[model samples]
Target: MSYTVALFRSILFWIAFFVMSSISSIGGVIALPISHRGTIFFVRIWAQAHRIFCRFLLGQTIVVEGEMPDIPVLYVFKHESAFETVEQPMLFKHPAVFAKEELFSIPVWGQAARFYGLIPVDRDGGGKAMRAMLGAAKAALAAGRPLVLFAEGTRVPHGEAPQLRPGFAGMYRLLGIPVIPVAVNSGLAFPPRRWVKWPGTITYRIGETIPAGLPREEAEARVRVAINALNPPEALLESN
Candidate 1:
């Protein structure tokens, strides 16, 4: 698609997405004081609706290449852009995400995130912060909710493979559950640091699950390879 047309569609999608987010945030806020489940229910609907808008308006559709586990597992996703983050709640049932603490500071959205059982990670804080995050994660695991995490910690541009962050290893050893590593090419369709949304399919390839009980370094290595399976092998070598 031409840049002009892509730009227009991207703008329209963003406007609709944010408007829906605001409306959903209101619903989440109202349900927050009453029922946490009700808040999550509204949020999931919002995420699905956003996907629909992207499908019809921006000509983008998500194609899942592998099956998502029926039971709760630690999900380590390749963070290429906001696309997966927007689709996450819709993809899993009542998933507990480890999002940056700063995201939980947003007005109504922040409050709703906390009530929805989203764990906050204080990146710059020391051991205390990690402990607090792990504590929250354990609670989520006990509740049987899938833990969604970005192994790279933040968005890495398309085609770049970064080493898995230190926290991922910590969680793997502590959580002691199967880890599902997901790779996505969302950045190609919805490129980061740009407004133009390309008309293409955003592929999410779920690699084989890595079982728990491995040493921290070994587990991290396996996850890094799994989540970057879609990337070139040279990229993986360079990242290491």
Candidate 2:
């Protein structure tokens, strides 16, 4: 019965994604010529739709723990599954997400990503890309947008461990905004690279905010600990 339900939810998830993507893609095209805010509005709507689908189809409820500060800040999150990727835009107001450069090359979604103020990452582009990322992040900061980045650079499955990417520290130093570490066990409910969406609560555990202007090492250490707080002791040790 569990397997049957998982299969049913998996099929429905894809169908829901297709429907949502179509509407968002059309909305993205129409809003492109207007303003970035217009594009963001559509993206948020798409995110809200996903939240609804998660609840009604998969029986996964998303609960955000801890108070989210109203001011613009850097949100470094644990990337466990696509759930957070689809959910964060709606979780925060008009956040400027840092995503990979390749993602921006997708057809309709890519156009919307650009207008939504997603900062593309060129990991192998050497110092040039680094500078460009910093510049874009700074601009986002100046515009009063929360900067959201997956600290490990990519999603890791539940229980596996990986260190925070080096670029996270670099951005922490450059962005000069308060860093908020977010821990999520979304992988447990929505595993990476798979279609089985388990019925459970998906909690976004926001950790203590580390003040801005700390040395890179200190900030990284604090974030590493905070983001991995939800993991098992063994996994936390492995990450360390």
Top-TM-score structure, candidate number: 1
| Global lDDT of model 1 | 0.87
Writing each residue's lDDT as its tens digit, candidate 2 over 27-58 gives 98689988766787889889998988989888
User: Could you report the Cα RMSD, in angstroms, for every candidate shown?
Assistant: 1.2, 1.3
Residue 78 lDDT (model 2):
88
- Please give the CA lDDT of all the candidate structures: 0.87, 0.85
Looking at model 1, residue 229 earns an lDDT score of: 77
| Every model's TM-score | 0.96, 0.95
lDDT of 2: 0.85
Worst 10 residues of 1 by lDDT: 231-240
Q: RMSD, model 1, all Cα superposed? A: 1.2
Q: Model 1 compared with the native: what TM-score?
A: 0.96
